[model samples]
Target: MALTAFVCGCTGNDRSQPQAVVILGAASTKDLLSDIAEAASNSLDRPVEIEISTGPSHALAQQILSGAPADLYVSANRQWAEAVVDADLAEPAVDWLSNALVVVVPADPTVAVDRLEDLASESVKRVAIAGENVPAGIYAQQALSYYQLWEPLSASGKIIRGHDVRSTLAYAERGEVDAAIVYATDARLTDGVRVIARLDPASHSPIVYSLVRLHGESPAADAVYQFFVGDEARHIAERYGFQAFSVSQDEE
Candidate 1:
């Protein structure tokens, strides 16, 4: 009887353990999403362990395409999210947040360059940027093309490409590049880098973040998705310099 009771107790404990909700998100939202996940776990009183994977939005989407097991997908751009939805790996994605881009330099000046045009000056040699496939890079390319600087800058052989926005920011923070184009929220996240100029909204497409619930249909995924779209999550995202996605009050 004692042995049977012990086995039953162990089984019950194993069954009660929290289910993990795997979230694949853009590197830009890492800090904010972690906080939101923690808050949601507490409020819902559900045994949910949020496992997050962060990287360039495009790469994350690719991982999903390759059969990666992700319960939720939050991307820095709708383009990548749309890819996942179009592939039928996820339901239609919903707009979650908005952001803007900025040009940044190391906190300690290597030269007195501060404006977009300064990137063309002799003093600024290498500029760090995300890969063209990443949304930040796409937007940066568009902005530079709009200013008629893209061709010249590309020819100069001073463009340093990073796999993601965070990597580009790292290059700037370490002074590996004279300047970097990154999201404004990324600029705020690090004191090692200083914002020099914000890209005009007209320069490129409006930056929008989107979220989708990947196929799998689990209770844990549903709960986390609900928490993410709730008012509290919006407040947390806004605190991190992201604009809300215009969810109706009733929806909240």
Candidate 2:
């Protein structure tokens, strides 16, 4: 229950309680970050209590900039990391993982959609996507724009914008929307949603996850960051459908 409690992106943790490390992560990294946090604690000689906040990368960066107490920050894309660094809220960032975008629909034979462009069809009464500034949403817009579908789709008023990728995925999972654009890893994790199409990697900016330490740091927090970028966490991330930062960086 404690671990589950700490996984939320909102500010619900009791501030008075002593915690070893406080990490602010993007929504897509919730499960992966929690797994790494537990594994990193087990590897340490002493137990370290890790608390994580998960949400849109842009929103998380804004929280850190507005003076939220955080030891480590993991963003879903480099632009948000760059924004934090520009504000001098964090140190230089390092790429941690890579992911691809995909279009998802409920696992129903009734849906005849098969490609990203198909989302513009009249049959798709509703489509879920992250809000304008969220990393996943921005990427989704880029890909849709490349296919020249964004403007018309926006005008049609069928777009259902969510605060983050998870929320967007939730809409698809609950059948609130006919389709949603989210990370491939997110689509993989949810059972009710099935990926209908994979967006071409070249269609948009690279979806690189990055980490940065806050202005004030603690040894325990630094240790957790080190463990996160180390081989152990990298292996865990790969198992969860994330790609190596190095492999994707070269392509970028």
Candidate 3:
């Protein structure tokens, strides 16, 4: 997803100090967060103008550390969120959502990889995954390693690294790679790709999305944050195929 910003609430010459809230989020949450922001604007009394910028969680954290303007930070994993908190750039992070990894192929099915093991087959040429430092890449690495395929695939030079999960999925969507490992939520957003298998949750570390309030106090930003952690946002997240942390906990 391109780094885009959507304005919510009122827009026009009536700009009597519209609260501007900047949110730096993980790439996969782009659409989901936009919907939540729209709902938040409608429900909140004060007019809020929210600008969301998204990328790999690790990169976003680094940007925040480098003084990027962000009132809130939503990470795809806890590690990057904690990094911000550790730098005193934000408050303690809270678990908000969960996701599952999936193996996706082109919609036309050019590759013969119907299963995870098929990734190792001679017919499979390239496999796309996010960079090693990215959350999706970390999870994919763990899952591939769990199946004992990481080393062989890595040695064969078949692993194609993308800057982020969305870009990784694009590799499969465009048929540039034989397949890709991405979030289930991401696969749902695109019609150019088809999910062949869902990786077992036990194969990797839990895919938890963590949110934090960057050190500051903006009523608008706080309101949006509250709405995000509230029930309404949970329902919206579910609609986007994300599992709310509360729901996952209940399942456990």
Query: Which candidate leads in TM-score?
Result: 3
Candidate 2 residue 243 Cα shift, in angstroms, is 0.8
Give the TM-scores of the predictions, in the order they appear.
0.91, 0.89, 0.94
Q: Write the per-residue lDDT of candidate 3 for residues 128-163, one digit (tens) a residue.
A: 999999999999999999999999999999999999
| Over 4 Å off, model 1 | 1-15, 248-252
Candidate 2: list runs displaced more than 4 Å.
Answer: 1-19, 246-252
Error of 3 at 157 (Å): 0.5
1 against 2, candidate with superior lDDT? 1
Tens digit per residue, CA lDDT, model 1, 129-186: 8999999999999998898878888999889998889899999999889999999999
Count clashes in each candidate, considering only residues at least 3 apart in sequence or on different chains.
Answer: 0, 1, 0
TM-score-sorted candidate list, best first: 3, 1, 2
RMSD of each: 7.3, 5.5, 3.2
lDDT of 2 by residue, 95-208 (tens): 888999999998763567788778888887788899999999999999888888899888999888998999999998888889999999999897988888898988889889
Q: How far out, in Å, is residue 135 in model 1?
A: 0.7
Better of 2 and 3 by lDDT: 3
What C-alpha lDDT does candidate 3 achieve relative to the native structure? 0.90
